[model samples]
Target: RSASNERAGRRSRPAERAGRAPAPRLAAATPPPAFARLGQAAATFSAGAAPTSRATRRSAREDGRRDASTAGSPLTRTVVRVLEVVPTRLRIALAALVGLGLLLGAATVVQTVRRRRLERQRRRLIADVGVLQSALLPEIPEHIGGARVTAAYRPAEGLAAGGDFYDAFELPGGRTAVLVGDISGHGRDVVPLTALARYNLRAYLEAGLTPRATLHVAANVLAPHIGDRQVTIAAAIFDPGMGRLTYACAGHGPPLLLGTDATPVTACSSPPIGAGAPTGRRQTTIALAPGATACFHTDGLDEVPVASGRLGREGVAEELRAVGPEGDSAELLARIVRRSEHQPDDMAACIITALPGGADRWCLRLEELEVDAETLNSGWAERFLLACGVGRPHLGTALLEAREIVARDGTAVIEVRVGEALAEVRVAAPPAVMLPIERRPAGSSAAAEAG
Candidate 1:
């Protein structure tokens, strides 16, 4: 009975060792209850939180699969694997950088659209103002009365229009009236005042009033309408029949008289028109010789910039002298404007030159001649051409051209001038006429004949 009891105890001991080994295997196979709850909470937090990027969600799913596969492994091993896979700080920094880039791209697109819209509106405004300026200031005629008239105008650089104006027109009894003026301020606002002063002064002069009286009347008429603006004007009446020029100044620069022993007509001036009642203005009369030039200009001519300072009145005079006595008025003004270093204001200039011979001498006596006579009598025309120093061949050509013109046009005035180097012929039909004339230089004619 003792031997049988010993065998039973040994069998029980082996069974106990086997059960202990299986117990450890069971524990490794399944996670603890606390670890399972922690894993479930982590899944809930991932699902309930704000939506993450596709890459982040994919990585989270992969981490979950790996943790499930390693469930039979140690808990410390699972924790170390999660820490290696997740990089919260680096991912947050990358996301912030991407968001900033998107914000900047949207801002650039908005700014570009706004800038283009503003540019289009500004260009359209400039075009409209240019058209208005042209209508306000018309072109001056080439001839007024018996004198040759020429003018040039240049607005300030980068401006469409400015406050300088000039006008000339024929008056009664073969007299010419002229005006050159400057308004106080620039741009579109001053244009109306400029028109008012110019047209009103013209009306007064055409009424046969003297220059001083004309200025006085113009000031009174414009005073009420000019508002706070002022106008500087130089007005003149030239009578070729009387060989005289009468002028008045109203706070304006003096008109320059060239090609004679004459001085600037700048005395007896008053304040600019529209500044107070017109008073104490006087007209100065000067003898204008044949071939003399009368030049009138706005302040822009003298206000040009130079190395020393403003070109000034003396600089303008020097430029005029450099143009020489023979330079045409239009050409001279062009040269002066081209030489200016900077143009800060509007420039306007006009010139009237008395013909070398009297107005009648330049016109053929066509009114007294018989146009329909059988032979077209040219004896008188020949004598007039000879008096003008025309040679025999040029004289014959002038007579034949004149006779042909009269026969075709009924009545025509012909102008003939003979010089050492050139001969010119001008034919016109009249009331007010600008003749197209041709000049033949002696050298060129001789060369043609030889060829």
Candidate 2:
């Protein structure tokens, strides 16, 4: 019986040892939550135990699937949000492009309009210049009384209007006065003054005023309007009935006289019309011989510098003589102009040749006036006498005849003795052209005095 009890004690000892920890509960017998928690813990432990092993890989795959589902699900939602922003950004970029295009179009249109406006203004100004230039008549009366007049008008380049003008109109006494003037300054600014000068001169000339009186009136009339600008004028009145010229100058050059010998001479001129402090004086009378020639010109001719390097009257006289007797009035003028071919100044000249009347006889005479008899040497006198067509042998005889008259009057005059009669022969200045001389009627003292 004791042996049987020992076997039983052995078996009971095994059970006691097994029941010491109360035999941990089986995963299947634990509560559902606990069992699930316990299963997750076992899987996590398996993954950690061998991270690269097949069992851990299976556990990792299961966890990865859950993670993928949780994280990848938001990718679609993020893509949708990005797509929503694309349209707004594109709209902004397209709007900016449209705005830039509008600005460029506006700029182009503004430039086009401005350019067109400027072109229109330019055209208008050009038209205005044309009108102003055309207002000056191209045709000048070639014949006025016994005098033939021709003029030339050349405008300066780039100038809107010139300051030069000339007029010829009959006075109230049936005599005609010629007026030529140059107002200072240019452009349309001078147009008003030019018109005023024209009308005023016409009115004054028609009022039968002398050249000097007309100039005085004109100066006063223009003084209020002239401002700082002044005028240069050469005005004259010719009385055909009396063969006399009344003249006045306003700081202008003297007219040239063409003597019968074809030699150029100068007129004795008074002070310019507006130049003198005492208002200047006028030349009441200038005796124009029957065949004498008068030439009026602007300073442009005289002002040109010659090869000799002289200016004004000196140069002009030299040039005129250089042209020689081969050239006529027009030819000489052309030659004078050619000397200053490239000059910048404008030139104008008026030449008058007086022709004698029909059925009349005239003689041309030349005399040198000097006080000293030594100055009047025979050679010098002979040369002038020869030029005047007086015989050399008769020169002393002519001088003797002239001395007799001088002895009686304390003056000297030489009478050139020519074999031919004075009635048929004609003489002229410059020898380029000849004019007839009419005999004065008897008892016409005024006319004779004027001649």
Candidate 3:
């Protein structure tokens, strides 16, 4: 009986403690504002996260309505009451509108990022192209082989760069070689070929090959690679010590000899390389008078647009004469740009001028041809020998020797070195090569072409 009574007392005491624990604290407590509850109820109907249960959401709205009625302003209470009666479709439409606005903002940000990335890529491409152009058309020094040398290049209006290129470098001996060439077309396709041609010709010239040999080798090498295109090329070997300029062309403009002489002989020509015809077959040798300037260029300079028509070879000569011995390639190009209304093609030019004060001007000159032994035996060969300073018994003996060598070897090389009053002719054995190497010999090197 005592145990039963203790259990009853323990249960009654807990009930008594619960009833007295919190009933006295109501007056001292700080209650939450009713308007704050109203705001929470508003958020539930907005684009915010949905309530976990519909029953819970309804109960909260009911509690907020009562709280608003008890303590909120008339406006707050009216809004809460309207939220409770709002249709489900209207709420969903409002949420959808908000989501659409967010999507549009995201799209705008993505587009801005993409545009910036593309702009950076464009700038990089431009920089790379600039570097490539510099490699293909490099800058050269002011002098080569003791003569003032300058070069210029200009692309057409629509091209960043083009097919034309030029180079000038000192050779193995005290000679200087200048090269200029034009590929038939333009754009990216031509740049690789331009580099190939420029460097290939330069390599041969640097290796002590004559201008004619250089072109011959270059023509064969490039023919296989250059599809449906031709390379018009010119190369010159200038010996300042010897005061002589020897040059050859392959379907390209001849080097202009200005100031002292009118121009280079251009009547003879080998077709452009890669044209299914032989090149480097012939070369012209000229004596350079002091104060003389040699201009080597691609055809574009002569083809520049002018008031009357294209700038012809005459115009080029006139410009060089105006620029005179003192002017470099840069100055000459500047004048051309000013005179030209537009450039129709890529132009490249190299200018080489001999020193003003030098030794006595050379009077001996030979622009030759390959004549038959009969022609050499003719009276013409005798006069030629006499003019070369060969006399009497030796002249007869030299003529007989030339005939015998021409008949025996099918051809031999004749080297002529004539000074003020002295002329010397040498008949030398030809070098071993695939083609007849004309070092100013066989005027059949086309018959080594006799002059």
> Could you say which candidate leads in TM-score?
3
Give lDDT tens digits, candidate 1, residues 1-451.
Answer: 8999999989988999877765443445788999999999999998889688999988998788677657766776675576556597976786789899999999988998888886787566655655565466657777678677776766666545577888888987777788888887777777777777778877777777766667767777777887888888888887788676767777777667676664432322367887764432434556666677778889888888777788877777777777654565567667766777778887887777775554322221111111222324736555555555567887677667767777777654545433234546555542222222457999999999999
Which residue window of length 10 is worst by lDDT in model 3? 366-375
Q: 380 in model 2: Cα distance from truth in Å?
A: 34
Better TM-score candidate (1, 3)? 3
Deviation (Å) of 62 in candidate 2: 61
lDDT pick, better of 1 and 2: 1
Per-residue accuracy of model 3 over 1-451 as CA lDDT, tens digit each: 9999999999999899888775564566655789768777898767466536888888887887788766778887787677667787987897799899999999999999999998898677656655576578877887677577889876666535678888888885667788988899866888899999999989888777777778878988899889999999988888877777888888887777766653334433567998886567556677776678888888887888899898888888788878888887767777787898898776788998876444335555543323346557566556655655566877777667777877877644444455555556666554444533336544546664543
User: Which lDDT value does model 2 have at 168?
Assistant: 69
How many pairs of residues collide in each model? 0, 7, 19
Displacement of residue 198 (Cα, Å) in model 3 is: 1.5
lDDT of 2: 0.56
Q: Name the weakest run of 10 consecutive residues (lDDT summed) in model 1.
A: 361-370
The list of candidate 1 runs beyond 4 A from truth reads: 1-128, 157-161, 265-268, 324-337, 359-451
Could you tell me the TM-score of candidate 3? 0.57
After TM-score superposition, the amount by which residue 71's alpha carbon in candidate 1 deviates from its true location, in angstroms, is 36
In TM-score terms, candidate 2 sits at: 0.46
RMSD of 1: 21.0
